[model samples]
Target: MKIGLYFGSFNPIHIGHLVIANHLVEHSDLDQIWFVVTPHNPFKKKSSLLDNYQRLEMVYRATKDYPKLQPSDIEFNLPQPNYTINTLVYLQEKHPDYKFSLIMGEDNLKSFHKWKNYELILENHHIYVYPRLSKGHVETQFDNHKKIHHIDAPIMELSSTFIRSAIKAGKNIQPMLPQHVWEYLDEMNFYK
Candidate 1:
């Protein structure tokens, strides 16, 4: 099986995420997409993040109906400030028969060289880049690389930060999130 590891903070999984995942499964060679929820992204601020379990649950609720999509807490068991290279290596060892690819946005690809052992990741795994609005057109050194593929998936300007801010401001965010996720957030009084 070819699995695409779509890593994110998923402070609250939203529609943009769903759209991207669905698009990848339908249009790419990926057999499945695992939403690898990062417990602590080195690039992000830990103080602004919700609990790992909460974020994982919201992802689960949002993607439960899609068999091709799964919510994974793989990084939670790994070290703090999880690095992509380590996770990929561990996954390869545990699931030797399954091939894994990295799925990310073009904005992330623009700064991917700064990631730990990024060159090793590029050499070993396939990378699928999806477009994100307002990031501007970024041309990478590896644009012509065979292992790296740029996909024309639908772009959404929506972000978890925007959703959280809307909720905190007492604004309606039902349209931004999955129905079940919105209900879960309301029931738990999250992000308010």
Candidate 2:
């Protein structure tokens, strides 16, 4: 099976994430999309992030109804400060028959070259890029790269940071999250 690894912190899974994953599976050739919930993101601060298992629970709730979209906590057991390359390598070893690819936004593609062993990753796996409302140019090297594919998915401006802040301020961000995910966060009183 061809799996698209959509890695993220998923502090609390939201509708925007589901939309992207659903769109990709339905529109693209990918067979499934695994939401690889990272324990810690190298570019993000860990202070505002929720517990790894808690965040994973939210993801599980959000994607329960979608068979094509599944939640993954594969990075939790890996060493801290882990990179995409390490995850890719580990996944390949465990499931050599499955073709794994990356699912990222254009914003991430802009700085992808700086990622650890990016060249190696490009050489081994395909990267599916979605649109995002962000500034800066992608490196010319990746513009027409055969291994990189720009998918015309929805440009999701919604972010976990914005949702977290809204909840803390007593705002009704219910519609922004999946029904089950919203209920879970509300019951746990997270970010508030």
Candidate 3:
């Protein structure tokens, strides 16, 4: 099966995430999208992230209805400062039968060069980059890569950082997150 790996911290899953996953499955030839919940993204700030299990559960709640969108806890067992190249290597070794591709935003594509073994990832796997704020920049730079694809994914300004701040200020996050995810966060007093 062809799997598109949508790796993120998922500090709390939201509608924007579901929209992109749906777009990828519906528009692309990918069989499914696995939400690889990262324990600690090398480029992101660790201070704001919730526990890996909690983040994974939120992703589960958000994507429960979509069979094509499944949550994966693969990185939870790996070492800290989760690197995409290592994770990809591990996944390839374990699931040799399945073809793995990357589903990342255009913003990330701009900084892809800084990632460890970036060339290996580009050579071995397909990268589906959804358009983001930095559209022109990302597209221009990615023109050199044959394995890269550009897709039209809605650019919602909503972010996990914004949601976390809202929750900390006792604001409602219903507009940003799925109802099931909101309920889960409420029950656990998450982001508080």
- Give the Cα lDDT of each candidate: 0.91, 0.91, 0.87
Candidate 1 vs candidate 3: the TM-score winner is: 1
Local accuracy of candidate 3 as per-residue lDDT tens digits, 86-186? 89999999999999999988778878888899989998999998877653563456676789988877876678888999999999788789999999999
Task: Report the alpha-carbon TM-score of model 2 versus the true structure.
Answer: 0.94
Q: Candidate 2: list runs displaced more than 4 Å.
A: 41-45, 135-139
Residue 192 in model 2: lDDT: 89
The per-residue C-alpha lDDT of model 3 at residue 16 equals 89
Put down candidate 1 lDDT per residue, 81-186, tens digits, no spaces: 6689999999999999999999999888888889999989989999999988764676878788889999999988898999988999999989999998999999
Against the correct fold, how does model 1 do in TM-score?
0.94
- By lDDT, the better pick of 2 and 3 is 2
Candidate 3 displacement at residue 93 in angstroms: 1.4
Local lDDT at 79 for model 2: 87
The TM-scores of all predictions, comma-separated, are: 0.94, 0.94, 0.91
Model 1 residue-pair collision total: 0
Give the lDDT of residue 142 in candidate 2.
93
